[model samples]
Target: MNFLGFFNITTVALALMFIGSIGMLVVKKPIDKVILYSIVDAGFLLAVVTFKYLDVAFAIAILGPVSTIIFLMSILKIDRIRHNNREGGPNV
Candidate 1:
């Protein structure tokens, strides 16, 4: 690809990362934060691939969703615990 094309892709990747980071700071909900985290991960993966690091990009592709799943599960667990406490439900 031409340098201009590479530059455009890199610019888009960085923009996505920047937007995700800003959104993470601004959003109040835990789910929103997790979503933004995934966006940032996607941007990073794109940037890696743009730089021609196929191996690292592959690793990120495999691990990014796993880490996002972990984040989501943690958020769900926390929400459940909070709801139980509020409702006076039995302890898990």
Candidate 2:
């Protein structure tokens, strides 16, 4: 591609990453965090795709869902721990 095309794609990828960072900082919920992470991952993948690195893009895309799932699981675990702490002791 031409220089202009390359510049445009890079600009878009940067914008996506910036927006994802903002979302990650501003949002407090687990679901929102997951979404923001997905956006960031997408931005990275877009950058790779723009540079014609299809193998890297495919690898990143495949890993995205697993990362998201792990994030969700951690969030749930934290919430459960907090809840248990608040409840004082185990039930009879």
TM-score of each model, in listed order? 0.82, 0.82
Which candidate achieves the best lDDT against the true structure? 1
**Cα miss at 21, model 2 (Å)?**
1.1
Q: Whole-model lDDT, candidate 1? A: 0.92
**Candidate 1: clashing residue pairs, number:** 0
Q: All models: lDDT?
A: 0.92, 0.86
Writing each residue's lDDT as its tens digit, candidate 2 over 1-92 gives 57776568788898889999999999988788888888888888898999999998898889888988888998888888878778985522
Q: For model 1, how does the per-residue alpha-carbon lDDT over 1-92 read when each residue is reduced to its tens digit? A: 57776558889899999999999999999988998998999899999999999999999999888999999999999999999999999757
Q: What is the C-alpha RMSD of each candidate to the true structure, in Å?
A: 3.3, 4.1
What candidate 1 gets wrong by more than 4 Å, as runs, is 1-7, 89-91
Off by over 4 Å in 2: 1-7, 90-92
